[model samples]
Structures are given as C-alpha cells and as structure tokens.
Target: MLRIKGTIGDWPVDLSVEMDDADWARLAQNLPTVAVAPSAQVAAQPAAAGPADKLWLAAQDLLRRSGSVEGPELMDELEALAGSTGAAKGLLVRLRHSPKVKIEVRDGVQVFNWVEE
Candidate 1:
C-alpha cells in the first residue's frame, strides 16, 4: 500500500494505492533499462539546454518584445510556449520576483514589464 497526502494550490490531495506482490513483480519486470555500447559509452555527452533554461529565455524574449504585458495574457502566452500551465506559472512567479523585472498594478490587474537598463 502507498499513501500520498499533499496540497496543490488551494486544493488538498489524498491518495491511497495498493499493489500485490505479483503487481510489484510485473512492474519491476517491465521497468526500462538502458544498454550503452562500450564505444558509445566512452563518448562525451553533448551539453543540452534544459526545459527551465528554454523557458527562461522565452520569457525574457517575450517581456522584452512586449515591453509591458498583463499577467493573465502573459500566462496564456507562456503556457502555449511552454506546453504546460504549471511551467508557465512557475516562470511567471520567477519573473515577478526577478530584479530585471518591474511589476505594477494597472486597473486592478498585475502588469509585468522588463526593466530597461
């Protein structure tokens, strides 16, 4: 049996799952394993930009191009660009606190603007 309790935003989550021995055995059997060739294993892995890096760059570009953008509108655009609401929200929060960003409330809504140097 597995139990999980947590909160996502304002919502509470409580989940319980049970697995028998056979279930665990089947799951273990189906788990994936990587088989690297000896020659390939010796090769250096290429540096790749992670999702967060890409998202940060995209967010910076968006803010720079738009000058100032409404919070909801920015969130929508970010969600489309990042392909996930959670990622968009995380980026927005980071942007909100970034020293390079300027936040203001306009007509009861938050507006985010890139601070020009």
Candidate 2:
C-alpha cells in the first residue's frame, strides 16, 4: 500500500494505492539489486565513488568557489564541467534539492548559493 498527500499548485492532492503479493513480486523483480559485503569485509574497505559522485563534487566546488552565481551562469559552468547540456541540467536539478545548497530569486533572476555546513 502507498499513500501520497501533497499540494499541486493551489490544489490539494490525496492518492492511495493497494497492491497484492503478486504485484509486489513483479515490482521487486523489475528492480535492480546491489551486492552486499560481509560485515568484516565492509569494515575493512571504504565504499567506491562512482562517476556521478565525482560530478556532484565538482558542481558543489564550483558553487562554493563562486559564493553565489546566477542560474544561467551556473548552468554554463555546469555544462562545461559535465561536458553536455543534458547532464549539466541533471546536476543542476540535483543541486537544487541538495541540503548543502540554496536557491533564491533576486532582481527577477534565480541565484544558486552554497550553504556552508
């Protein structure tokens, strides 16, 4: 069972979904799984960082060094860092949702800023 409650624009939304065991089995089968390390093995090694983690770090570094930057300029810099407009957009979306960053509108333009921990 799943329940979702939120507001869409000015409208309130409430949703509910119920699934049987078979449905859950189908969902699980469609999902990807990661291999887990044994307790001792895990404690002995640090987790590996993937490409997305590297890109995210670079994006954060860019914003931190700039202090604050307008959306368009930030997008331009992200595009260069990501090497593609599509990937840059993805990074921008991730940053927008990140706890370490904040977005504000000033002079009718959106600005992205790094939130120091």
Which candidate leads the pack in TM-score? 2
How many residue pairs collide in each prediction? 0, 0
RMSD of each: 13.7, 10.9
Clashing pairs in 2: none
lDDT of 2 by residue, 1-117 (tens): 545689999999999777565654454343323322234323344457434545556677778878899999999988877777877776676677667888899999999998999
Off by over 4 Å in 1: 1-48
What is the Cα-based TM-score of model 1?
0.58
| Candidate 1 C-alpha lDDT tens digits along 22-85 | 6544533332222222232123333373334444555667787799999999999877765678
Model 1, residue 63: C-alpha shift (Å): 0.9
Please give the lDDT score at residue 109 for candidate 2: 94
lDDT of the structure predicted as candidate 1 = 0.66
